[model samples]
Target: MKKYRITVNGKTYEVEVEEITAPAPAPKKETPSVSTIEAPKAKAEPAPTPAATPKKATPAGKLTINAPMPGTILSIKAKPGSAVKKGQVIMILEAMKMENEILAPQDGKILSIEVTEGSSVNTGDILAVME
Candidate 1:
């Protein structure tokens, strides 16, 4: 075993590590609370990952309403393919201990409701599309 001392912010600690020979492969373990996300497969093979450069996202619709800040979706007041009026409440986004109504910015059919109640969203995340 080898011992080493570490100091951080005026604190010190000792650690020991031992060398092992011919180590066996460790068993793979899965946690009960961990979920494995599988991506869509193409023709029985794994899809290739995208390039390092982020693809420019297609510009969202002109009349789409986006999240104002990071928050939880407290409620959804509209559905997909429904007609909505300008300034109508589409969802209640909760942030900073207050519920902010996410309203529509234009009169159009609700192309999609991107989030459901209890969803966590961030600033500039698309919440709904109108077209």
Candidate 2:
């Protein structure tokens, strides 16, 4: 076992790790002959149709806010049609156990929010649109 101290976000944590060793190989066992049994055939089924989900339309010539990293949305601080200032926190995203603030790029009115709380998003994924 090995012990180590780690620091993250100005916090320190002590942890212990256990090392594992490979075990010896097991002896081979005899298998049943293929000719002894006959397998039944399976019938193919059609794939189920997905439910329709309504999508919000984005206006043209609007600024889009995108996620900077892959994470789950923790909370939304602003709503659609709300006015926001530059550098204002619009939402919070939880990534790698860290809460990252999603800020507005510029002063504008939010046209729409693309993601809800608890939704997962990846880098470059659109989070909202503003005018």
Candidate 3:
């Protein structure tokens, strides 16, 4: 037999263990019955369909740009009506002590500028619109 002390979360406990020399008892076995009843079958159900998302309708000729992460708008390089190419950097964002370039998603003119220099923004916050 052995004894030990244990502490957990500011709580203390004492434990003891003893060696066994006797053999373990044999497990019991059951006989199968000759006459068994079967369970009733359940009806199959149809799978549920996912609900359609309601789209945010941007003005017909315009599009909305959202922030990719939480950050401060460091600078704006595009103004309203400024022509931009797909993947062109329109703004600089500072997030997590790193600078990130917010780019135009498609070749289009800047329809509107929603954020200004030094403005803090969260993920998915609209930054600008291009069309």
lDDT (10s digit) by residue, model 1, range 22-90 = 879998696568789998876776889855532224355546677899999999999998898988999
The runs of at least 3 residues in candidate 3 whose Cα sits more than 4 Å from the true structure, single-residue gaps closed, are 1-57
Ranking of models by TM-score: 2, 3, 1
Candidate 1 residue 74 Cα shift, in angstroms, is 0.5
lDDT of 3 by residue, 84-109 (tens): 99999999999999999999999999
lDDT of 2 by residue, 74-124 (tens): 999999999999999999999999999999999999988999999998777
What is the TM-score (0 to 1) of candidate 2? 0.56
Which candidate leads in lDDT?
A: 2
The clash tally of candidate 3 reads 0
68 Cα displacement, candidate 2 (Å) = 0.5
TM-score of each: 0.54, 0.56, 0.55
User: Candidate 2 at residue 61, lDDT?
Assistant: 85
Model 3 poorest ten-residue lDDT run: 49-58
Task: Give me the overall lDDT of model 3.
Answer: 0.89
Report the lDDT of model 2 for residue 118. 98
